[model samples]
Target: MNDERDRLEDLNIEEAVGRSTPPDLAERILAAAGKRELDDAVTPISGRHAVPRTHRPTGRRMTSPIARKNWQGAGVVTAFALLFVVGLIAFILLNDPSAPTEQDTAETQEKTDQDRNQPRQRFETPTKKREPSSPDSNEEQPTQPAPTDEPEPESEPDKPEDVVDQPEPRAPVEEPQPEPRDTVKEPEPEPEQPKEEPVKPEPEQPKGAVEQPKDDDKTEVKPEPKKVAVAYIPEDAWRKYEFGRYSVRRSASDEWNSIHGLEKEMGRIWLYEGWQLKTGTGELYFSNGALLQLDGEVEFHTHTRGLRIELIDDDLYVDNVASSSTVFVTHEGLEVEVGNGAAVIESSSGKLGIFCVDGQVSAGGKLIAAGHKASLSNRGLSSINEVTRRDWSHPLLTGARLRQLGIEDFDPAPLGGMISGKIETRTAEQLGLDDDGHVAVDNGGSASVAFRFDGDHETLRGEKVRVRYRVKGAKKLILQMFCPARNDNFGTDIVPGKEGEWNVLEIALSDLRNRETHKDAPPPGTVLSSFALALTGQDDAQIEVDWVELVREAEFEK
Candidate 1:
């Protein structure tokens, strides 16, 4: 058995020796293992098979196994990265934040349409800040706290001890809240109605009372005419003054009866022919609107045609004569036929002065025109002088002219010691004068009383000077003309024939010369600055001037 076992062991040892390869075979196994390691270092983890390295059929050498494996792995990774980028781009497009969805766009369009259809509403905003609560107990509170059973304390009267211990209450904090928005209300749609046809307006009727038309056979009514009024004078007419003193007498067959019983009668008294009417310082009006102004004493007889006035004394101013044919008999037995005009007749010292203020007068068969004065006596009419100018004719220095010369109102001033006098304004009746009414004078006693004219006397050149005056208890009256430019004076003396009676004295410029001896006299045409009058008489001497005037002699011619 031992011998057989020995033979087997020898055979195994020989086989083992056979299995132990040569060195070249060992090197070939190591090189194959190295190639696997290099492939693992470059192969991707995706488990792809690595391509085998081979040489080209030509001369080119094949690529390395590791390089081929790296190339395959790189291609696989690039494909995967491209897929990842494409997926990220698709996600961004689907989830864009600024783009609106389909549902959101529809909702925004609907909201805009609603706003356009609705009406806007307005709300007034408050301008003042809200105020905190007041401390007074009686004041109403803006907000009330939850009420309790116990009454609220009356804000305990401010105690000094409590003030230091207590802190001021803080205003409650207001949380932020959304403001209430003004809601717009949509207008309701109007209901539709059926259409109707239009109606036409009717014609209007006229108003007010209407008169019916008359037929052809009807006659029209006519209005009556009116009557006019007529004026007439009674035959038995008489008038007595409501004021003044007078007496009347009636004429009968060879007898005279006193009409004093009829003095109180307001009715007309029958004035018969040959009846006499006497008046003493009074006035009377006839029934025909005639006025008889009598001064002093006057007697008149009612004639058949008119009246025969006996101017016993004083003067008579007769106005508004009813009869143009009335005849007046003066105290000198001269008859004056007066027309429808006013006449002033004065009878003094048996001389009658008749002045016709308006209309014409006939005395002693001579016609005296209006504004003319005529002197009459028992021998009939004497001289007739025109008192006023006609039309544009040059006027003479009459009473009106003297007034124009600033002599109507006299202001008296003493001229040295040689004169002492006063001036007075007298009426025509008081001066017993006629023609252009009122007169003025200087009544005093002095050696010489100077009268200065208020205006310039240049108008007195080449004129005749006439002065009518009455002197009482004076021997002579002298008038002097003073020319201030030449410092010279001219004068003339008057010799009176009657005392206490008006007398006219005239002086011509041709006769004027310097009265003072050894003084140069002014030429004939020299203007006078002032005029003076001198009265030589005793202490009781007084004088009255009726009028002083300058006239042209040719003015008196017919």
Candidate 2:
């Protein structure tokens, strides 16, 4: 047995790799390969490499022991392959210190067999129900362990070997023992979801929810009692039945009803047509809040609003013109407007006189100031004289009756003619030019101060309308001419002059633009219904009009 063991030891792994090789072994190997040796081939002896025993030089690796081996064609290659495979397996078994020992493997294998024989208790990896993720969190939400129906994953018992680290550190497969531990976990109950209630449609308002009133149950609105227009005589006022008396009638075709007594009610309770007080004096009141005192022959014709006194020649005093009402006194060619004031208007043979007592008067485009006298004619107004003591005063107009109109505190200081029938009269001072009395207006958000002229605008057709006036807080000043013959409105905006001073703008009538077409206006014929000057801008603006001058200019070339 000892001889056999020695023999086995000798054949264990060929020879030691440190043994030197023979010189002629290379030539023999080359001869077997059927090739000649290289010219530079030199042999190197193994023992004393610094010196050579033979005269010829040897190769650097000629003395190696393994090269001297007498192996044949494929025998050496096969031996090397077997040795490499054996070395790889030995390295795997011995590299890791944590790798199982032979005793440990045997113990574990014995335990595994015992466990299998008793009964395989299949263990399942606990699966979890994933929790709902929060909208703001980036991390995955951990899951809760839940009971599952699937059995244990016993089929992959050797799965840890595959999961272990790669070959260099792979042998300690038992260290990753989570496969069994991950299977054991306490079961967690899932959170119950709240149930949502079903939404029902809302019912509309029931038709019978509110009871309808029957014909008898319905309430009716009582009609408002209308205030009637009235005229009565006051006992304190004096009157005369001398030459003629006051006459009242309904229509123009009806006969005049004479009023001679001191009867309180003279005019009817409604609108009447003819009124002629041609005698000493008369006092009358219309329910429209208009009080009138006529001195001479004064005739109040028919009117829809207030009185239309067509005086051929008479002195008529008016007061307390009700809200939104007018008292038109049309004489020869003179237009005089008085508001809450006394004025004696006289006319004798183409001559007229305006005597203002308490307030200002606008007569023939001239402001007749209080305590001043002005001569009025067909031409215009002139001869202004201040009176120390007023010679003319109203006998019956005591100003006590204005309270019945409810506007006793209201200032109707006449803003001149806003239009034909929309004229409010009162003496107003405007700026420093109040010596001639100016008009300030606040027609309830109407931003205009307009004056209308009934005189001949035909002569001014081809001329420039030069106006001299002082204004405050106004924007554009518009001059308009309404032609009845053409039935068109010709208007032009005057460029503003120096501020805080009187402005004189000479605008040609030919330059008036057609409001609709925004072009030069055509010739406005002789029949112009209204020639007006209006200021537009700044609410409640004031304007003092000195004069509306016309310069006769030759017609422009077409």
Candidate 3:
């Protein structure tokens, strides 16, 4: 063993040049030894050299000793390099481990098939530590001894090539190992936790998904979504919203007549060519299933030929999403939309404003996408502004644009209440109003004031009534809500925290409860009546209000 290791260590290039001999000196010694042997065997020709190597070979060299001894040392070096490289590569491959061939594997399978009748004998992978002096060297190192139970097979004992070619010496035929690409990779040492304490895992991701990192050896489970109960809408949705008393005319020159009673009535009413809306907020359903809600002092004329609405004098709200034809909202003969669209229109002085709440709308013959506001006048002047990052909830939701005014709502209309209060407007040269406009209220003495909601916003998230007021010399404030469903009043007392500072009172319409029973009396979102605020304790108490906004929350907030 000692002599075999010493001879193999001599072949190592790193250990040889570092300790045994210098690389250049070894080459020179080999050259000199070869020359001396050739000189003793053959005579050298004086002043004569070998033929040029680049030219093709003509015949065997039969003359010079230089040519004869030239290939001997180089042949030894080349053979040594080839053998060393082959053995190193083979050792690396065998150590890496692979699936054994049928001849080497000794798996004990039941006698189900002919091949599984007898288990094959297992053979260890043969290792090579060859240290050859040359390709033609007669000296060869013996292989390591196998286990005592399994005797090693003797095949071509004198030749190393025969031992390499016939890896399984005992077997009749050589068998190749399974290809590395086809074999499954060895599993990595993953979780070392005890199998008895198995952890609950998250919803099993689809196969081939990358595993997420573990937290305290536990996988978090995803929550299922909550289902929301939606109210069933009937085929005749117009019956739900009690339509107001409207005037109808057969022709443009004919006089209009009041056909329906003044109370809140249900059912669809067919409109003629010259049908018009009278006083108060009214809901109109066209023959083509278009729902139009008109508020303020809007004098809109309906044209059933193309489902076009002509705003003759005031403003209108067209949410014709269910309409079969394109519900066009025209101001002064100029249409705003050419497709199925829901939009809000408002006209204050001479300028007209069209806001595309959803779907597409047209402005000055050019189409604009949703969430965009377009302002136009009869003088062929128009400007379009995008209402970005806004999930507008209701048709009444509008505001000042591009820093024109800091006010949020501009569509404030007086909900009927007999009181002394002040109303203010915040619009200038354009129509960007959300709530009917801001109501700047100032009380001269202790008195009650009321506000009305112009449009009935029955949205998914519902509407909110916001009131901001400040009082002096008042002990308690009363917020009374008039519910039309009960035709009665439900109020709650609000104790002001601060005396002179503005106190905000914002509550959802659906959250409004009756003070007597603490139950939601209305049970509906369309709180279209009046909201009254009264100061009863102090006689000389003065109240100052900023604004009262009736708006809906955005979609993303839900």
Candidate 4:
């Protein structure tokens, strides 16, 4: 059994050696061994048989142990050569320094195309692991790899021909999805809006010539007529009449007869320039409702429009109850326009007076209200003063009217005795008192003048006396109250301030009693017969007195 096992071992070894050996391997081993044997043969062999040992070839394959050993050695040599070849191939694969392969080229081309189409990408730097260093070191340290000696490749301009042809990578296939039944498309962008400008309004058209439609046919437009202000009179109207010593004239024609004292046939009468008319003791009435009464001479021209009279001289009174435009002009250049009532105009050398009795009158640029008087002069008009009841007295006071006061002899002796002066009564205007025609006492010579008020004794008892006087050269004035029936009297002296100016003096009737000297003086309620203005010891003094009035003390205070 041991011999059989040795044979199987030897056979298995022989098979392995045969598979590992090359076809020319035996010839190479034989050539190397034959040469070594020949060299050994030259060393001169010491044997009787000097020939080398040679074996004859047989037809059958040798299976000797020595042949098996040779086969084993050849197998070992073949295994070693195969291992050396594999190591060389692995080294070449790992350390190859060539350019990119085909797949890498495809990926690079796709990345470049994406970069050109999409927006630019910013490369992020890789973070490197930091090595801790000693804090004591002050030398500058390199934070990154140092620059290499190799020059960078020049970036060539991209020519169309230099671009390589590469197939685009296929995108991954996705699973098929079900199609929706309805599709909604996105709305397109709206067109740009236009800017707007401000709009203006239309202008207004005129009134008469307003714009009309083009289809209108009316053409003629009549303008309204203007108004006219005038009065029409007949040719045969009564235009001229004569009264007392005056010749009636109409526009310079003096053929008209006198219509004086004719009541029914009275009408308008026109007086020419310088033609005087006197309405002597009767009023002259006109058919146009004008009534004129003259105290002295009056020359006037009558306007046909409104029967306006222009007075040339003297004084006249008009009752213009029927006309509103009945105006009168004075010789002193005053225009007195009366309306609806009576008015009186008195004209003298350098003065004019207008009194509105019942209605308004416009005189001297001012309206004289009813019961008022306007005293005007060449210096224009003064302030209008209220008219008293005595202002409407008779226009003229003659000697006969003065004699009716019981002083028939024209003497001052019957009443209070006068001073060494002549007493003259004149119009207030003549005495430089421009009041409306009130009487004034003028003292010519001067020992002091005295005038007595001749009224009932009981009329002024217990009444206050108010006197308005204008004095020129008198320094003082005295008023005396006397009861002639009782033969007792008392007097009060006044030092007049504002010489040559009008002043008012008021005295209570009770205050006139002489309490200091005449203890038997009259009581407060005693009736006084007369009051006198007696100026004593005033030499060369001229005094003009306006008025003296007795009123109740309560009325004077009001």
Candidate 5:
């Protein structure tokens, strides 16, 4: 058995050697031995090559004895090698202790740098490692600070790869830093909204950009009345009869006449042509504010009394008893009063006249007659000292123009011209007189001319006619006419040309319609019932009247 074991061992050894031997081994052995032994030793096999070994080098060995050994020896060899490597590692560690520590720190810094590079990972790391203890341990490992984290104002910058592990500090600082930059960028984009507000500006049109228009103002206008003209012959003739008011047109001619007595209930009065007064005697009391107007001649006896009388282009014949008669004369708006009817005419603006056929005459106030004296009382032709007055040297009334027309006595005449029968006079009481000698044939030194005409004395009963007259010494004259048929009154006021001038006065017959007398009558009738004239005071106080003419102005429009 032993022998067999030894044999087995030898065989094993040989087998190991055979597996490990190089290709040139046999030749190298022969060269070292310096002999040719191969031919006898075994002309050994079917495969045998013989090579010369003289060129082989010496002392180059490849195989070890232990490597060629069986399993136990191989195990023992491996154990020895392990032990040697351990010893070498122990030597390195013992010599420098900081090396391992430094290595560990360097690994941690690399991880820290990676964490810093990945900001999302840094924010997520704490959630992954939720335990406070684990995070603290991770933090305790010294690491490079993250570059993404905002630097402290006092802190220096850190390197890129060395900034991975400081997750908590870097996360908060970087988060807020980006927010500030985002806030700055956010405001920069929204200021473009103001361009949309300018489209609503249409309110400037009515604020005075356009202008407006204008209109006119003067001139007196008169509205046409229902009845324009009228004519009436008083039914009863007034002799010594007193009247409240009476207006008559000369049913005989185009001339007009009107009379008013202010007494209460004096009854209807009468009128006649030429104002011829016989023994017709009665007093007219005008204590009740009656207005009277005379167109032709108004005769006053000691029996009649009156308050206000206006005359137009006519003579005012007065006796001694008809005193204290206030006569207001008007051409237009001018007015004047003659205190008493003593053969005197008072006008407000223009000429005045008195017809003194029988009674002693006196003149006062501003007299316009060339021969008439100022305040001269021409009593019974007792000529006073001749007061030679110069002719009007004014441009308005040059003597050359005055002489051309042969303007004469600015006085009233009994008749305008030569007539037929001795101007007939009649009274309301049916008293008639033939001659001028019977004018004041009574118990008193008084005379009144009164008469009445036929009702159909003219073709048209009533029609409108204007009266034209020349007023002496009238710088400005106004003539007014009053009609009692309708109780209407109208007048015209004249403007003086210059000083000391005679003015021609024209009056409209339509204006003299009597409103009260014909209240319900139609507008265009031809009755001129009463008339009044007045001369209001002006620069030229002297006045004379002549040649009363009548003209028709207008007919009432339908």
Candidate 6:
């Protein structure tokens, strides 16, 4: 418009000064506008780039002088590196805050002494502080929480209540004391048991003094003492007594026959004779003279006497008989064993003491030159001849010793002539005769027979004899004549009888062998004739006799 609008306003004002003039901008705008217009160049160009044509600054605003002197030497080394990083951050916050508070108080006292000694250090540090925390109670596995600031427990919590409140404190020790001496002493001895207790009390005091005398005499005892005896006596007063005491009265009547002491008067006691009555009683007989008896118990019809024979107590009895003959019978020296045929005739005209107690007898005539003499233990010394003419050879016959005293057989020729047991006679001084013819055939010719004989040799010679002569006071009387078959002596005789008195003899002997006027002699075989008796007495003179026998044939038997 105004020029074109003024030429388009000068082409829009020179393209606004060539677009603000840049192309090295005139070397910087003429070096500042040539020193800026030397003085007051602009003060207001500030931000928008302050457009300036050809002032060139914009390659991001311009720098280049070598980059501006390398940015002002990098601003003086960055202001000294920012004052050395502010003094090294204040010297690491002043020595790292007391070295982290002295390593945080020595790691909180080594974690409160590893939480009281490493409670296993939390099971030994797994991954520290890695927390996902929550599982706690199976009783709270304890570990961590220890540090100190004020929670003090470093060792105290060394637990179990600190091993129960801690009180073991002692240490400083010492004591010992005592010892240092040497004294010096020695002596001891003793124990011998008090000298054996006084020698055992002297043997117990004699056993308590011998038991105190057996306990003090217990009751007055004295015992022991005895002896005393005496006896002896004998001075004969009939030699004293005592055996069976005493006795003797006697005299109870065994027929006194008026007797007073003795001397005859005991009659009637015949048999073989025994009689002593006068109170010592005795009477015996039996060979048929009969009168055997004893006390009649009082019926005395008489007959008893003096001391005919007696023995009492050893009892032999008899007395006062014939109270009709059977009053008190028999028993004297009883022994009458007479058997073997009895023909006993013993009678020496008187009995002094007769005992034959047996049998056998045969004697002929002339009362055999007076009496007495019939002795034979066995038999011997006997003679009888009816008529003698003296002649006897060997006629001392006791044949076979009288058949050994039991005489069973006998019969030596009987003619009333030879009666002889045995006979041998001579010794009148060998028969110059005298000396009273020395005949002693048991003192015959008197009070019957006196006997006692035990024979060795026996004899009896017989013949019809008659012999008697006893001159009690001598004139002459001597005879011994024995004849068996032939030695002979036939001297006649003279006689005297009456000294003790008794005699009667008449011996014819067949007229001295005339055999009644010569009957041819020598027919008397072994003949023996006898008649003998001669005694001038005095050999205890006893003569008495009675004779009578003349038998040729006279048989008398009772």
**Candidate of highest lDDT:** 1
Deviation (Å) of 202 in candidate 5: 99
For all candidates in order, the CA lDDT equals 0.46, 0.44, 0.45, 0.45, 0.29, 0.26
| Candidate number that wins on TM-score, 1 or 2 | 2
lDDT tens readout by residue for model 5, 1-558: 999999988876654433222222333343323222211122211112212121223432222232334545765888899999989986897798566676786899899877644422222333445556422222333334458575333322221221121111111111101111111110110111111111111233343333211111001011111110111122233432323233333222333222432111223332211232212122222222111323243332111222223344333322221222333333233333333222223322244433221123344334232223232222211232322323122111121110000111112122222111122222423222221211111111111111111120111112233322223234344444333443554444456334433245543443442334522322333333223333445333433222233322111111
Q: Which candidate, 2 or 4, has the higher lDDT?
A: 4
Candidate 4, after superposition: displacement of residue 212 in Å? 58
Candidate 6, residues 1-558: lDDT per residue as tens digits? 455678767765554433221122222333334322212123122222121222332333222223345655776898899999999976887776455565666888887765653322223233323445422211234344577455533331211110111122332222211121112111111111111111000111222222211221212122111111000011111123322111111134222222212121121111101223322222233211122222221111111311122222222222111111111111232111222112112222121111211122222221222112232221333443222222111021111011111010012211223222222243445433343222222342321111111111112111233333223443334333334444553334355545433344543233343222333232222233343444444455443222212111111121
Per residue, candidate 1 scores C-alpha lDDT tens digits across 455-484 of 345532234666777777788877877777
lDDT tens digits by residue: candidate 4, 1-558: 999999978875654333222222333344434432332333223222122222224533233324445655776898799899989975775577685666886899999777643321111112211324321122233333348665454433322221222222333323222222112111111111011111111232243453322221111111111111111111122222222333232222333223332222112233323344443433443223244655555544444334445555677666654332454555645566776556677877767787766557776677887677887787778898887766656453110010000111122232333332344565545645443443335463343434444433342223466776666666567777667666666667788657767777877666675524744545544656555664533555566555555543211100
Candidate 5 structure lDDT = 0.29
Model 2 agreement with the true structure over 298-323: per-residue lDDT tens digits = 55542444345656555655553211
Tell me which residue pairs clash in candidate 4: none
Which RMSD does model 1 reach against the true structure?
Answer: 61.7
Each candidate's TM vs. the true structure? Answer: 0.25, 0.26, 0.27, 0.25, 0.17, 0.15
Which ten-residue region of model 2 has the weakest summed lDDT? 189-198
Q: Which candidate do you rate higher for TM-score, 2 or 4?
A: 2
Task: Report how far off residue 364 is in candidate 4 (Å).
Answer: 1.7
Residue 258 of model 3 has an lDDT of 42
